[model samples]
Every structure is written in C-alpha cells, then in structure tokens.
Target: MVAREQFQVELSKLRGDIISLAHETEKLLEKSLEALYNQDIDMANDIISYDTKLDQKELKINEDAILLIARQQPVATDLRRLIIALRISSDLERMGDNAKNIAKSTIHLGEEHGLTIHPALTDMKNIALKMVDLSIKAFEYEDITLARKLSELDDLVDSMYGEIIREMLEETATNPQKIQHIMQMAFSARYIERFADHTTNIGESILYLVKGETLNLNE
Candidate 1:
C-alpha cells in the first residue's frame, strides 16, 4: 500500500511536469509569431536557441515516466496515465520544433525588403496558439468534452491556412520580386497549421487516456 501511495505521488508529479512543458511550448509558439510579425531576428534566434531547453524538458519527462512505469508496474488507467504522459510530452516537443521552424522562417523573412506580413498568418497563429493551450488544459483536467471541441477549432485553422495559400499564390504571380518573402511567409503558415494538428493529437491522447478511444481529426 505504501508503494501504491508512492506511485500516486509520482504520477501527480509527472502530470505537473507535462503541464510545465506545455506552458513552455505555448510561450515558444507565441514568441515565434512575435518574432516574425515584428521582424525581430534576434528574438527569432533566441527562440531557435531555446529549442534545446524544450528538448531537455522532454528528456526529463521521459526519464521520470519510464522509472515510474518500471517501478510501479501500474495497471489499467494508471498505466494509461503514464503512457499518455510520454505521448503528450512528445507532442509538445514537436510543437517546440514547429515553433523553431517558424522562427527560422522569420530569419529569412527579415532579410527581404518591402514585404508586408501576411494578415491571415496572424489569424492562424492566434487560433493554433489557443488550440495548444486548450489541449493542454483538456489533458490536465481530463476533460474529454474539451478534447472533442478541439477538432472544430482545428477545422477553423485549416480554413485560415487555405486563405493564406490563396493569397500567396496570387501574390507570387503578380509580384514575382517578392516571391522569396512570400514563400517564407507560406512556410510559417504551414508551421502553424502543423502545430494545430499536433495540438489536436494531444487532444486525442487525452481522449485515449480518459475514455480509451481514438480520434482521428485529420479524417
């Protein structure tokens, strides 16, 4: 019984760690966008440098989760809890990479002259950032209903992505001189869209943890 109690305490600590990682990932996303929107290459470079911190955080979560699984030998929902912790950590870590890629795009964008930031990209970034936050909340609260709502938000992000692509295509044909800048903005849009997909995956992971079901929002 003491061992079981110890396992619960460790499990709670794992949850706290995942939430902290999620918070850092959320900040990364925000700063990546701010760097691009404001044309701040130094801030963008800082985000790129900060990717190492996120990787270290993920490694710590994995280490603790593995130790708990091996020592506690949890069953049923307890086992699911540990598995989802690892999965969510990976998803959050990937979100960090997405932010890094967005930051890299900003560096390329900064070198170009006479280019306006794509308005639709900002809209996509706002919704994707919200999805990341809400998905983390859904996991923390074990709220399957909140998880279910994320797919709709993801759909909105997709629509915004579509708008950005159309604008990019039109601008490319009309203003060929800005092709380099336009393409970089398109890459940033893709990064944000991919981040939204990762957030949806986190929501699905929460559903699997809470109710043992699969949700494929991509379909």
Candidate 2:
C-alpha cells in the first residue's frame, strides 16, 4: 500500500478508538449516576473498578495518536486531526475521572445516609449525559452548529448545578447532622458540572478542528 493510504488507515483507526473511548466514558457516567440515585454501594464500587479500563483506553488512544504524528509527520489538516483526537481523548479521560469521583461521593454518602437524590441533581446528570453524547456527534460530523449548541446545554447544566447547591445548603442549615451527606451530594453535583465542562471542551476542539480557530465554549 502507498504511504498515503496507510496514513489514511491509521487516521481512521484513531478516530474509531476515540469513538470507543467516548462511548465507554459515557456509559461510566451513566452508571455512576445510577449508583448515586440508587445508593448502591456495590454498583459504585464496580464503577470505580471499571474506571481503570477507561484509563487504559485513553492511554492507548494517546499513544496511537502520538505514534501517528511521529510516523506520518502529518501537516495541515492531517496534523489538526491528530491534535484534535489527542485533545478529545484527554477530555474524555478526565470526564471518566469525574465519573469516578461521583462514584466515590456515592460511597462516601453510604447506604445509611437515607438522603434523597435531588430532582435538580437528576436533571444535571441527564443534561450532562446528553452533552457528552452530542459532543461526540458534533466531533464525528464536524458540525459547528451542533458543537456551538453544546454551550447552551452546558449552561443548563450549570444552572441546575447552582440550584442543587442552593437547595443542599438550605437543607444543611436545617439538619446539621446530615451535613456530611449534603456535602457529598454537592461534590457529586460539582463533578457532573465539571463533566459537562469537559464536554464543552470537546465541542471547542471540534470547532477548532473544523475552522482552524480557537473558541472558548467553556465561557
């Protein structure tokens, strides 16, 4: 095969690896939320255990991307593709860490806390997950409009996060004994909010790859 053809193949494989990592991260986020909602210690532990797999997947993607750049010495659009892949993979890996953090928060809350999951918190999780999904789609399609839309979704997540925090603070004031549980719930909400922030980063990455300019969707 020609060198150009081989490069194309490697590029395609890199894209596939990124998509796989994205999907795995998304599932991890979903499971973490489920464990929090159900207060399932066992499930939370499993999610923590599964986080290592995401780490490995991310490492592989990073290594593959680096090797492609080294071997192909890609320039212009090809170079941009590899760079964006690296950025997206890093974002996805951090997103996985946030999910792991959420699982840890669930464990910290413990089964005996008897704390009810806040509806606003649930809304944050749902919107965060949707943002994750849409970010991947925007990257796959190179859709600037879809990528821009993620900031709007992220704004919603931020709004919901603030609502959860305010409500938790009010609850904590009324029931000082449950302050620890409330703090854990607040941390989980922050993690979800951060997860959405990373999704917005991916959206920014997509925009950069397509338009060759930097845009701060996080702001």
RMSD after CA superposition, every candidate: 1.4, 1.4
* Candidate-wise lDDT, in order: 0.89, 0.91
- Give the top-scoring candidate (lDDT): 2
Q: What TM-score do all the candidates reach, one by one?
A: 0.96, 0.97
How well does candidate 2 score on lDDT at residue 123? 79
Shift of residue 157 alpha carbon in model 2, Å: 0.6
Winner by TM-score: 2
| Residue 177 accuracy (lDDT) in model 1 | 88
lDDT tens digits, residue span 95-188, model 2: 9999999999999998888888887777788888899889989988888899999999998888888888999999999999999899999999
Candidate 2: lDDT of 140? 82
Q: Worst 10-residue stretch by lDDT in candidate 1?
A: 210-219
The TM-score that candidate 2 achieves is 0.97
The number of clashing residue pairs in each candidate reads: 0, 0
Tens digits of per-residue lDDT for model 1, 1-219: 365787788899999999989889889999999898889999999999999899999999999999998988888889999999999999999999999999999988775457888877878888988888789889889998888888999999998898889989999999998888889889999999999999899988988988876767554
